[model samples]
Target: MADQRQHVQGTLSELGTPLARCTFVIVDLETTGSRPGEARITEIGAVKVCGGEILGEFSTLVDPGVAIPPSITLLTGITQAMVAEAPRIEAVLPGFLEFAALDRGTVLVAHNAPFDTGFLRAACGEHGYDWPAPTVVDTVTLARRLVTRDEVSNHKLGTLAGFFGVGAQPSHRALDDARATVGVLHGLFERLGSFGVDTIEEVRGLRATPTSAQRGKRHLADDVPESPGVYVFTDAKGDALYIGKSANMRKRVRSYFTAAETRGRIREMIPLVEGVTAIACGTGVEAEVRELRLIAERKPPYNRHSRNPERSVWLRLTREAFPRLSIVRAVRDDGAPVVGPFRSSREAELAREALHHALPLRQCTQRLSPKKTVPACVLAEIGKCGAPCEGHESPEDYARHGEAAREAMTGDPHRVVEALTERIAALSAELRYEEAALYRDRLAAFLRAAARSQRLSALAAIGHMVAARREETGWEICVVRHGRLAASGLMPLDSDPHAYVRALVATAETVPPGTGPTPRAHASEMECVLHWLDAPGVRLVELDHPWTCPSSGAERYRDLTDWDRASPSTTRR
Candidate 1:
């Protein structure tokens, strides 16, 4: 046992502040009930330890001043007779608090902290003693995050004690349970060390701690700059491992090497990272756009989203005698209007459903000649579709419904918005809340797509423009073309801002218009720029044309996206 204690102390010293140097108070309480205000603590047991050695121990039976219930007696084996001669809580608490005070950095450990802490706090409040809030570690929360369900049947104190081969078994007695908890606590610390959790900060934020391999690469972040930039982590083969943007490249890059990064995939990839490279930007907005472009171009293996526009799906209104909404992989300039660049086919399908339900447009996939007749699908009989396949609706009339759907997809979304709003209201009134939420989600998807389309359209229509926002030391200038950032730079504050703006415009990098039908890369870059322009206190210094969303369009539905409200109707304009 002496050798084991020395080994534990040695292992802790190699980590941050030697765990051996810190004081931990493992506490347990036998209580009458779960809550503190309503129930009272029958017994308090605590063991204080440092350097893997027990420094002190405290145990007491408290007179709760109430009759002990039969169920409580059965659970804890503490009867009124057991505490008949015991000191009252008011008399016992003061000594316990003194014993637990911090000579070194002190921490309170409990199986499930709230239960113990809550009762202790209540006891202090009732007795008119101020409760000192100390650093607390809940083994229950730690176990849940670190241990898999397969490792143990449960996170209960007894289960953990048995699993860790604790000498003292919890027998519904406070002291035994407190001792067992100390064993469990040590076992957890050992497990966390394997995952690169060493310091008290890492232990407190264990859930976000990176893997041991990632922590081993802390040296790689030494040279990173403290500036807005895009960073790429690379493998030994010189291939990109992961790409990210940050307002502070040094801080963000350093976080990957510490216990602060919680992402499982990033932690796995960090071991492969042999180096990191960064490109500084004038502003956070520029860094974001550069990150997106690099991720899209490099196709980094670890980048999950926005790496490939080809994989994105869109809802298209096909050009035919009777237009129908269909989910397609790529958008084409085939004179057929498209609603998205939606993140997934599922979202596009939802938007398609919302539009179909609102507008009496055809839902067929077949190409119908103006005179040819084809069998209609069940959607026609259900009154969801216009049945243009069966010639039940004339081309002119079907075209009007198709036009309305197209309008909603492009700019005007009032009809579709009202339809979904009414449906959500009806479903909520009927107590079909789940179905209402589904409709609400579908409505939000449509509105978001419509809003994006309108914003992109407005920006693209301007062709070319220059905008500037005032900064502390200079003017941040950006040259935009077809809604995308053509170039951006920082110009020192000059008496004549126009001269610096011209120089910035001349020096900025030129990116040609995208060749793809949707211009997704350009659209993404434009979205980044739009986000920057909309930032608070940003002022547009110059423009070739006015930049604005459609006056009475999908932009108005921005408020409806707040789905957390009890009723959308109450928040709707």
Candidate 2:
């Protein structure tokens, strides 16, 4: 048998202080049974060691206050007589807790930690002693990862101890089993060293052995800075494989090589990643904005959403004699107001239905002239529209209602919201629950669209603005123009604020004039900028135009949109 003292001392010296300096207390318990709440611990054995040197040893027998089962006595060779003169569990638990106090980087090691820890924890709870939740390391978990099934018969303590030629053998005695575990633990440490695992953090975080491809690309993260930023994983041909944001670029990027990355898509992408690039940002918000812009510009193969601006749909008020809501794929400046940049045509149509239900807006597909004479449609007959097609309603009067509908879409949504609220209440009162739900969803969609429109409109009206917030090392500054991020940088606390501001403005990115009707890319950027500006404690440094949303905006109809109350529909009636 190997000298236990020499094996531990040798391992500690070679591994250095991070692993060497750790104090490991290997523990084992012989109990009446497996259930912690009901099973009583008959014997407790522990060996506390540091750097392979045994620092202390503890062993005790405890009276369970109950008769030991014949089966358990046969398995453990412990009976009622063995613990008859011994102190009760309550008396023995205090000393054990003190011995395992989790200060000074102490770690508790067991073959299967939960089994032993559970009994100890239950004893603490029952005896009214606080459980300190010491950091636990299970050798069984380590064995599963380190030794393959082909190399070991099983993960049992005796199996591992026999495989490693441990000095002490577990024979149903607590102290002998705990000593055997110490040997198994040292052997596992030696295996971990082959994979360059040295630190306690590495051991604790070790999930699976890295693949050869992952191991080869480990150097890609060597120079990645540990800061908030956006990271792009590129393929062998330099095509962006994936783009992600993280507070710690190095840590996040490194995680892709481990078993923690269970997403099969990401796993497939990882092996193809030949390069890793990081764009460092001053603040997390800046990193988020950059991620959005980069994804929009690149439309990277792996990115699912926010990849294509052309895919966006909008709700446009047509520029005609009698304007009607139309769902279009693009935005145009035709002298008529637009509400969205909505996610889909379906969502935009829902908002349109809500507005049409509340106002007499023409729904005809044909363009009508003031002098034209045509038959009115069923919508006109049902009073859903003021028919300008047949000249039944005068163009001037129809235009007035069109203006009200436009106001509900853009600035004030209270009128439309109130009308929908009453309609929903009436439907629910008649027990037409599905119809009421349909109207409720329509109202919610309109309210959301209106709120987005109002915010985007207000942001677009601001020609340019400068916002700042104090940071630990400096000030975070951003310049926004027409709802897009123009420039963003960090100004050091020691630098002149005015001079830095001027420098930032001089080097700010030139935003191109609005190309499409929706300007979805700029709108997305604007939303990002607005979110940052709205964050608590942000200071408005400068503004070419006042940052304001319509006071009578969609927010006023917030309470009317609640669908949770049992009688929410009654409020409108």
Best by TM-score: 2
Best by lDDT: 2
> Please, what are the lDDT tens digits per residue for candidate 1 over residues 312-420?
6778888778778888887775657676667667778888888977998776677887688988899888888777788888889888997888788776899998998
Can you tell me which runs of candidate 1 are displaced by over 4 Å? 1-35, 38-216, 378-386, 392-394, 422-438, 494-496, 509-524, 563-573
- State the lDDT at 37 in candidate 1: 89
Error of 1 at 12 (Å): 34
lDDT of 2 at 115: 98
User: Which digits, one per residue and each the tens of the lDDT, describe model 2 over residues 1-573?
Assistant: 111233110110122236788899999999999999999999999999988889998999989888899999999899899999999999998888778666445899999999999999999899898888877889999899999999888999999999999999998889999999999999998887555566566677777777777667778887889888888989888888788787778866776675434456766677898999999987766787788778878877777666776666777788777888888876775656677667667768888898889988888888888887799899977888777888877878888887897788778888887898898888878888778877876887777767777788777777678899887878899987677777788888999999999998888877644532234245666666777888787998889888788899886776544542335344434
Instruction: Give the CA lDDT, 0 to 100, for residue 357 in model 1.
Output: 75
The positional error of residue 371 in candidate 2, measured at the CA in angstroms, is 2.4
- Model 2 ranges with Cα > 4 A deviation: 1-143, 156-209, 512-521, 559-573
